[model samples]
Target: MKKENLPPFKITNEILTLIYEIGELIGKISVTQEFEKNLILRRENRIKTIYSSLAIEQNTLTLEQVTDVINGKRVLAPLKDIKEVQNAYEIYERLDELNDNSVKDLLLAHKIMTSELIKENGKFRSKNAGVYQGEKLIHMGSMPAHIPELINNLFLWLKNSKEHPLIKAAVFHYEFEFIHPFQDGNGRIGRLWHTLILSKWKDFFGWLPIESLVQKYQKEYYTAINNSNRDGESTEFILFMLKIINETLIELIENQKMTDKMTDKMTDKNKKRIEVILKYLSQKNYIDNKEAQNLLDVSEATAKRFLNKLVKENILEAVGEYKARKYIKK
Candidate 1:
């Protein structure tokens, strides 16, 4: 869409209220390093898990049950090669290691994460590409025959733009999705790299699960892209993403308030137990009896009971065989 025809990036009164509340919750969480760690871990894990599910759902997995596989749950669904998951994890793990705005890092991450799905993973496509809606091509766009030059221009724009971080990220996301740079896995890689760009702009954004929100509004997400294509540019998609960010922040704030209230009512011992559980969770989603004993500095029986109590109270979820059981935050 033309700039003039695009909707204003206006924050409504309701959104402003939600932002203020979210700011307060962010402040509260920032006060405790432990709380911050807990939240960030949950955010990152959920993002990776959801993206993995999305990747699997796109028919890349021949035998694997995508949903169960992504959740780390046991299932009867066929298992596909998990190299994609491994590559994505590697890129995500090294996100902070990247310090420059060069296209190399971006291309490398893309190539590695999508290697299995494309002939040119670390390199740009050599052929003309266009986005399709059903059997018909929707946009009559073509990339520079010199793929590297086109990617360089895109990165330059991304680095120099003074737009709001949210807007910039969303626009880049939609553009990348439209570009469909890779032969396959473009959608997943585009979303993933957009998040990487966003996290680089703001550390707080690294802890926000925008993908989860997008998944919840999957139809709208697709509609925003298709609608924007009917015109030109991605103004509609940008606005939609901004709304999602606002809603995600609001939900996070409400979750924090609930956690605070619940913890506030507990006794010192219970609070300590909760801290132990949260700490364990920060390292990994599931904790077993032996690890809980060491974390809580309690006997085995005591640790088991404590975990059981938490499960009974709906604070934790239990899974796996009895002898090898583990617990995760509910």
Candidate 2:
């Protein structure tokens, strides 16, 4: 196999500053009452991440549609749009199982993410590919025969590189796009894989939802990618992504503050119950009366009261019949 050299990138003051800012925000959030305990906020951020990431790829489904689709409800969007959401949801649900340094794992994720939408779902393209803006060709991908070798080298470098995880992941994302390994779904997979890389470094990043911010600056996103391509270095792209991550962490800290103020009057007992419920919900996605009781080591009445109170406060949505009802993070 041909071994290709990894692309070069220079870290500037901007990247270092953003990293420091992100770490400071994460430090503040780590001590907050809601950092790991805010179940509802985590779920909402997840939905936003999925919707916005797909939206950047022109998936037409709205946030509500994405939520409904995730809940296994019928959505009246194009079959392609619906399938993209379903596939992405499935991939993200098992992100912990993915290996960031394995090309095979990358292909498998692409397969899961593009299932039913592309004939070559998990496989790299056998033909050339080009990224275009309307009729303008912005970037032409590496030759098809070279993709495997190029990607293999990329992962090899990632495994051996001593670079910080943040910088390494940002560089990997940029190089992945430049390679355009797959004929379809490259953009989405690049973004998704970057999160996977970061999550492996810090599990908290698994639910950080940086993609939501990326979607907000969609034009700048492409411009950064284009500029990096032009410069043949990933400095600009790294800075751009670091900014997104920094902003996302800042938003998380801000949201945690809001939660603190809103729940200032909540009793210690009630706060503990919500924390327990959030942990359970994080793992199972929903908590029924029986499961809640078992998970919390509480009686049926107590579980029901706690769950009902959360529902009343708009922290969760109560679904199903009275006896069979379950509470899902809202």
Compute each candidate's TM-score over C-alphas: 0.70, 0.80
Model 2: residue 232 alpha-carbon error in angstroms: 0.8
Off by over 4 Å in 2: 1-4, 31-36, 268-330
lDDT of 2 at 110: 96
Residue-level lDDT tens digits of model 2 in 69-127: 99899989899999999999999988989999898899999999999998898999999
lDDT tens digits, residues 185-249, model 1?
Answer: 66766776667776786565655667767767887888888887765667677767767777776
* C-alpha lDDT of all candidate models, in order: 0.65, 0.86
Which pairs of residues collide in model 1? 1-232, 63-78, 64-78, 111-121
Best model number under lDDT:
2
Per-candidate Cα RMSD to the true structure, in Å, reads 5.9, 6.7
Lowest summed lDDT across 10 adjacent residues in model 1 is found at: 1-10
lDDT of 2: 0.86
Which residue pairs show backbone clashes in model 2? none
